[model samples]
Target chain A: MLTPLKEFATDIRIQQMEEFKARGFGHVGGSLSITDCLAALYGGIMRIDPKNPNWEDRDRLVVSKGHSGPALYAALALKGYFPLETLKTLNQNGTTLPSHCDRNLTPGVDMTTGSLGQGASTACGMALGLKLSGKDSRVYLILGDGECQEGQVWEMALFAAQHKLGNFIAFLDYNKRQLDGYVTDICDLEDPAAKFESFNWYVKRIKGDDPDKIYETILETQKNQKDRPAMIVLDTVKGGGVKQIEDTTLNHHLNMTTELADEIIKQLIKQKEG
Target chain B: MFKCIYNGEKETKAGKTVFGETIRKMIEEDPQVVYLDADLMNSIGTSGLEKSFPNQVIEVGIQEANMAGLSGGLSAVGKKPFMHTFASFAGRRCYDQVFISIAYAKNNVRVIGSDPGITSAYNGGTHMPFEDICLYRAIPHSTVIEFTDSAMTAALLPVIKERPGLTYCRLSRKNCIAIYSEDSVFEPGVANILRDGKDAVIFACGYMVSESLKAAETLEKEGISTAVVDMFTIKPLDTAKVLEFAEKTGAVVTAENGNVVGGLGAAVAGFLSETRPTPVIRVGVKDEFGQVGTPEYLAGVYGLTPADVVAAVKKSISLKK
Candidate 1:
């Protein structure tokens, strides 16, 4: 199980890198950082039907930091939501895969979100709606640590806790970097886990790069969620798994020439084979 | 199917009360209909709705942005959400949320903004929103409706729910001058001609609809024939009716309780300028912030009374070629 999940994460990274290569420039850092969690969710954890993307009983995922749409598109395509070949058209003229997550254009994308912190609120709405209807399907929200600077995120945090949305699980990608600089330098989140806990949420912090940990935390929290929404703070590296991009500081968005993309892909293949 | 039954009297039930009743009925009939309020439930007379339908009513504190995004999420999951707040918060405060989450994202939701324009009364400048119509009108493929009376308010709530896309309903919380009978059904994008005349037409909505009628009455007594039109659905501006009146009368005056820059006045003038170059005068507030005052006092201050409409109508007629 762990090996297959790791392979899924590796494939997502490779596919997303190729998609970014097609665009020549894209949001690489944020997208790379959340690949493991996306792999775990789409690969095994989430109960979604690739055939029927709009099935009412399916679990929903809302990515608040929507600039990392390539990561989601890669996962969706690998899971057969759409043909993987469609990834070549990322952000091209009239492409279904936009630079940001849009539900209208993409299948398997639960909610449209681009303006930061909005997905948190929408996720809570979905959780509450499911709770009201007595449907046990869970809603998973992926938020950027830097995006937490938006006041709307905390507003949703307060709301989710107050409503006791046990079916909602939020994963905050604490990659320590945003567009301008490190999140601490820009606007320190101080202690996000403590903040959510103070807001009455059950909180946990975990190393985000491991798919095994990511998959296990979700299953554990699913059992222990007693009237409180769960918040899993992912301690991750910006531009994780790619040494070339990880070595670069300003990697939130990068200009990746085709040659550079080939070199990185070769390095990734070498690591996978070895 | 639209008809006018204005008899020169106030509506027995306030617009908010009628809205509350309609919301109650919608929830009772449909299990998917959910009503969300931003701590203004009592202000909009929906405070008691939660008691009867607790699962359907959500008071989302005072966070308008959250309320807007939450409604989009609700709509995505097949719950028809109707969010209400002051016009200030509903239109300006959470403009981006409504635009991106609900309208641009193609989420099915209905947003009700209470106390539009001078109807906000003592809530002062911060509470008054003279630009909500303009804000909502700019969104791509959005329905903007301004409720003129209790009958219209009651009649249109269900229609808005069944409509396919995003909708913004600007309403008054208090009583309005009666403009339609209880049985009068309304379809959006159609004009309700209250009084017809060939001399000139007064296009109005909200508080100005009754004021325009009064102005038309005064114009009729002076042997100058004038028409009064309740242009309730402002966005898809009854272009057919506007063209008919503009061609027949060769003169037009728009009256609104809000600013002339982007309200009914702007819609009418902008359309006529492109379609047919006719004489048009806007009777509304001109780039001014609201202040704490009675609706009547503010109308006097902002020149929104019948006399003002009458003056604008004469000015429009004088400019006609």
Candidate 2:
């Protein structure tokens, strides 16, 4: 039986497929891999006002793995941040939706992120600012496993720990694949949970595709009394949920022909109806 | 119409102290103002600020790029962030963060890069940055300024704080010759004509402004009149003031404590070649690296004294037809 949040995730995944099919090319593997976590965040976990996207006390979400913008946009649209019909305009001329997340163009985007490791540092600043101002707002950040190769990520990890940013919670989308190839073949980040734990972040490794587990973990982490930041290493598969693309080894980005896109959309619609 | 009044003292106040005092005052006045440094609070004299406003001042130990992204993040949430670090690390070590996180994202951040150019004397070539101005000038909508002295540093702080977008402030940590009075007023993108003459005009910025003034006095003794313009703001270039002075003097000399290739010299020459074709001679480091030495020893070694400026002025005058 699908929980309400899992059903929401499935609808978002279908919308993401429709978006990529309309565009004919998009980052498919990584985008699909993180959809459930995005659904959990937008649906139940984050304290946000869809009508007032820039609410001062709203919990902030910065998708540091910004290439997964398609999934994020679907979640935002389904949450009524903007009209769901606008998702078809992804990457088109004069479209507000670009390939990567842009805070200026997107209504619900908290931080503009595309360059691998920059969003993590920005999230730290936001958390620090909120804490200094005596605001109870929390900040959530998402990062990719391959994005951890950037030295700036470690630099931010050190900073976040030293400052005791308890209001900051980061999710590492451990999708195991990058633009080049498998993460282990390129630059393995084995024991990522231990790596973050060594940096003084309270680490929680969870199955990313399970909406109930993601929501419960976020709640439990937020309840902890630790005076340090938290990191949830989400064990996800690249191109998860869909079997055909998930089986492909190098499905980071896809050049979707008419036939391939139609087949994916058919599967998505059937799953949605079921 | 700003005038420069030399106080005749070799030192008035250190730029870092003035920056520290001004930033401390800003933090006290505005709750929205936050300070970040790469563990150089003592180096830049901002340790006192950390003591008083512990929550507002963040000392990210030895992390320049992370500090920049942190500034961007703070700016995203409507907090005005001021970051300080050495020029070399601030520019070269964290150029990408300043480019994407701050400038490209259109977030407001004020970066203070202390000990610019030859002012990093005892710190050696590893710490000196001659290419900072070149790197910062490439960012669109970035306001880049080189502080001439303590007075200018104090005057420009509030102005830069209120302005939006990315602002880079290049200042020296130590004291230099005082060029402006304590009450001297300044406007962004406006060059100060310290002295007016007809023979030629010398465009100078940062530590080179004092050298230009001394060179003007030397030329006056030799019966050759010269005009001196303090071109403090580098990016916007103050092309109108440059063109007006270049047209009036008919010859130009650019003096800077940085490289002649892409510093103030290149900016002035590039503008003049397009607007007014004037004979411009650049008096600065001639495509070389820095070494550990005293300020005096380094000035002489790099030909950055008033004699070099005077020689360049005379040569430019001779080249003018």
| C-alpha root-mean-square deviation, each candidate | 1.1, 1.5
In model 2, the runs with Cα more than 4 Å from the true position are B1-3
**Candidate 2 local lDDT, A199-218, one digit each (tens):** 99988999999888899999
* lDDT (Cα, tens digit) per residue for candidate 2, span B1-321: 334678557555677788889999899899999999998999887886777898889888898989999999999888999999999888899999999899988999999999988889889999988888888988999999998988888888888988899999899989878888778888889889898989999999999998888999999999999999999999789999899989998999999888887888899999999988999999989888888988788999989999999999999999989
TM-score (2 decimals) of chain A in model 2: 0.97
List clashing residue pairs in candidate 2. none
The CAPRI quality class of candidate 2 comes to high
Clashes of each: 0, 0
